[model samples]
Target chain A: MAENILTPEEIIKRGELVFKKTKLMTDNELSYCPGCGHGVAHRITMEVIEELGLEEKTIGVAPVGCSVLAYEFMNVDMQEAAHGRAPAVATGIKRVYPDKTVFTYQGDGDLAAIGTAETLHACNRGENITIIFINNGIYGMTGGQMAPTTLPGMKSSTSPYGRDINMMGHPLKITELIAMLPGTVYVTRQAVHKPGLVRKAKKAIKKAFELQQENKGTTFVEIVSNCNSGWKMTPVDANNWLDKHMLDYYPLGDLKG
Target chain B: MEDVKLMKGNEAVAEAAIRAGVDAYFGYPITPQSEVIEYLMAEEPHKRTGMVVLQAESELAAINMVYGAAACGKKVMTSSSSPGISLKQEGISYIAGSELPCLIVDVVRGGPGLGTIQPSQADYFQMVKGGGHGDYRLIVLAPSTVQEMADFVELGFELAFKYRNPALILSDGVIGQMMEKVVLPPQKERLGDEEIDKRYGSWATTGKKNGRERNIITSLELKPERQEAHNLHLQAKYKEISEKEVRLEKINCENPDYLFVAYGSSARICQKAIQLAEEKGIKAGLLRPITLWPFPSKEINKLAEQVKGILVVEMSAGQMVEDVKLAVNGKVKVEHFGRFGGMVHSPDEVLEALETKIIGG
Candidate 1:
């Protein structure tokens, strides 16, 4: 009863409280474009890192995409890896110093396309690290381009006529693929388009990090993030669309569970 | 009175790593190199010696694990075949860029892609020519014997830590899988926690302190000139390394009209070819390289002064031949012979090339 002392609303406030308590480096600059899901993801991750007291030993690997300069925002001693190889680099960190808490922050284009092999292998091999994959359906850093997670008929800078399933096939179900791998002990899919969805995504991120701390093999968290700038939608409108169109194709829930 | 054992080159690398106080081992299962990981896992080094052996999700992850551990001043290593090594290029370059000391054992196989699981020396260019990106050179060790496979672990670690660079032990299927005698090195323990933190704590994310500055490892340079200067600095270090790090073996070069140069499995076959040629009254010798990037060029050049011709044998088409020619400086003609995509060149193939090309009619 005491453990559940804080409800979802209170927990978000408690996360905020934790953020203040840890005194993690905060910024109003919010490097993410307006309507980007990165802000929500960043808040939740920092809250968890603070909550679990991982600030001291935690080493975050930020990928090349939009979050290339994420290390600037986070208070922890973070390392930036080459595009799409964050998980691989995180694996290196975790194995080298099993004592440290290692996590990788990656985007859809980086994780699903250029880093497909590294992502699949890290999951299959069961590396003892955590991966936070931000899937916004399209590449945000290099303007809007088609991504593996981009929905069919989703138009972008590269895909002018929408992502044709006839040619590009389908949006890759990464979490679904990860669930099939024996190495992945914890695989979950979450969204940050709504308050309720934000809470669940936080839980998933926390759980994935907890799994690594418990040495429960590899853990993966797929966050259905929003790219307001790339999507040409306002932040609030992007979240609404994420709740509507993106959720229909992605469908939030623990794919592994 | 050491407990001696005959082992394959891959197994020897694992044993040597253990002896050299390697704190961590991360790798994926790729052919010609999987034995190293298998031996470490099956032997349970993690449980027995407090070592950390992990099978990473992918070659990329495995190499990153090495990067992480090496950041903390821990002696770390990863083993992979050619394709797997290619997957590791990004991380390798990052590690090199970060100036972290680590060991990478590449059990080369043939091919431009998914080449044979068999042995090949096809990755010479990738390994010696900075396979990853930017201005960087891995300290490469091409071991032709099972003994050197184990021996090079300490030597590689010494060089890596000394220069804060990645050291690669290059081998092929023939050497990686073949069983041969090896004299074991003395065992050492990984640096204790205090020493680890002391040595690497400056840059490694060991813990947070109130007053100390946060340390970050990255290769990203925003300004064009800054990036260029950083690359130039790395090149200068590489040039210094090249000047001092050349490792070569000269055999019977007295009045030599012909020189036999080879590496990894190809070098072993060339060794046999040289011996056979000598029995037939041909004045030929072998120039074998222990370090590939800081190539044995200086010694090779010195030998080329008197030798009429040099035979360059490798698993790939002609990657190392360029370096050989550059070393020879056009004084003596250099010809190449071997197979690619995991095909190990036999001694007969090498001898045929030697007789037809270097020895002449």
Candidate 2:
């Protein structure tokens, strides 16, 4: 049995290695909580940039959330923006460096709550930049507070009993809102929990970036993600909960691509 | 002879920015300064010099956009009025903290809140005393004329990049809207990526090329010790600016019984008041601070020795007078006289205040 199993060196020699980490990601360890989808989302984005050979020309805007430290992980020229200001910053960067590829990484709280104005306006203006929005339905970095995408009847730090739609209003379907904007050429909702879903999400991310080179307008790719620590659940349980519940409201597919 | 054009202060600024090789202009339409963006849109700077001019959703977006472009080692600017400037303060503070170079033109209107569209210098304190949060300073240049409006665009950018700090052109409605003869500077080419890399390669986030570490533009320092060290570095930069960039104009300071301290449009009024005071057999002088942040404190201290009294005139309710008082240190009498809420003081009123408040008192 020991002789039958191929050694690590023999596997490399046989070219059986199907996957490896992209060079576009730095060697620094991620600071995101274990089981958080942000790590997956970040890795996919860097892989897309690396595969597209855009590492030298890509400029990323990291928002004020758990993903705020994305600049430390994504090995690209990065500018960290104030909470909810990533889209405006990306607009500025793209406008000045028209030939460079620009994108913004924002969270549900940053994109749908504090940054709604920036998100809507930048998309409305047809800024030729990609926006990767992570919708975890809760504020992970701020200790599981209620977010704009938090589901109804969902319990959070702020909503201990459950989210009250009558009082707090309904969860905002921001990707749907973005899809309606004339400036947005492509808008999609994706997820990356399972291997199949991860592959699909990566394809969507690649399409969004490829569209950017065409100068079509704003391309928005939202990854419906999970926050195990925020939800007070194990990583495996969080993915199961997301599959059973989050998919009901945020059905993943292309909205306008 | 150089080409001269009779242009409004705001238009002159827009034209000067285009000629100065600005990479982008992001702004919103605000009273007293809408022409800055309008003229740029009309002139189509992109067609002229491949410059990017965008009308931002609000002043908040405009300034953040400036921060973004400035981070990439590009020359960018934004213009807004008093209330709009207040909205921009957060972004301005971030730019200062990040040590990015950019320009901000605050064509100030009268304000406590939505005050008036007419010119007022009430924002003097806000601009000079770090309008935004945090330990930082903006290199404030008060442009007194349409000519200065155009000239300061070039000078402001130069100083901003030299120190890697934000430079503000503080103009009131008078200078922003008034028409005057301005000798427009010759157009300069926008710097290419190669030139930017040569000049700002050490810091600017112009992409991680040439095997260098990825450049990150941010104001966040989580560590308390590191944050304190950053604040100290900013304080040192401001101190160096104060020592070398104090700018002011002294007229008839050779011999004077009294002096009028003013800036921007108020300085022009003081010039007339000085002549009127001379005609009344009273020797008066004017000291106009061109750079408001550095404040010309030392020059004011020296002038206090020769003049019996000093009257600080402004369109606001005497904001800069405090700076003058701080500099004078009670060696001579320092008084403030002004008309508030968009009111402009006439030469006669300023002269009367000087005689009664400073000379006679």
Evaluate candidate 1 and give its CAPRI docking class based on DockQ: acceptable
Clashing pairs in 2: none
Cα lDDT, model 2, residue B227: 99
Model 2 lDDT at residue B69: 95
Give model 1's TM-score versus the native structure.
0.86
User: Per-residue lDDT for B1-361 in model 1, tens only?
Assistant: 8868899889999988887888889888988788999899888887666788887777877887787667767788989989999989988999999888899998888787886888888888888888897778899999989999998899999999888889999888888999999888877877887787777677776555454555677777778999898888888888889889888887777778898888777777777887887788877888888788888887898899988889999888888899999999998889998777667677878878888987783
Name the lDDT of candidate 1: 0.83
In model 1, the runs with Cα more than 4 Å from the true position are A1-22, A26-30, A112-129, A172-222, A248-257, B112-118, B209-211, B271-274, B338-356, B359-361
Kept native contacts, as fractions per model, are 0.63, 0.74
lDDT of 2 by residue, B1-361 (tens): 7989999999999999999999999999989899999999999989999999999988889999999999999999999999999999999999999999999999989989999998899998788899889878999999889999999999999999999999999999999999999999999999999999999988888888878888999999889999999999999999999999989999989988898999999999999988888888999998999999988999999999998999999999889999999999999999999997998999999999987897777
lDDT of each: 0.83, 0.94
Each prediction's Cα RMSD? 5.3, 1.9
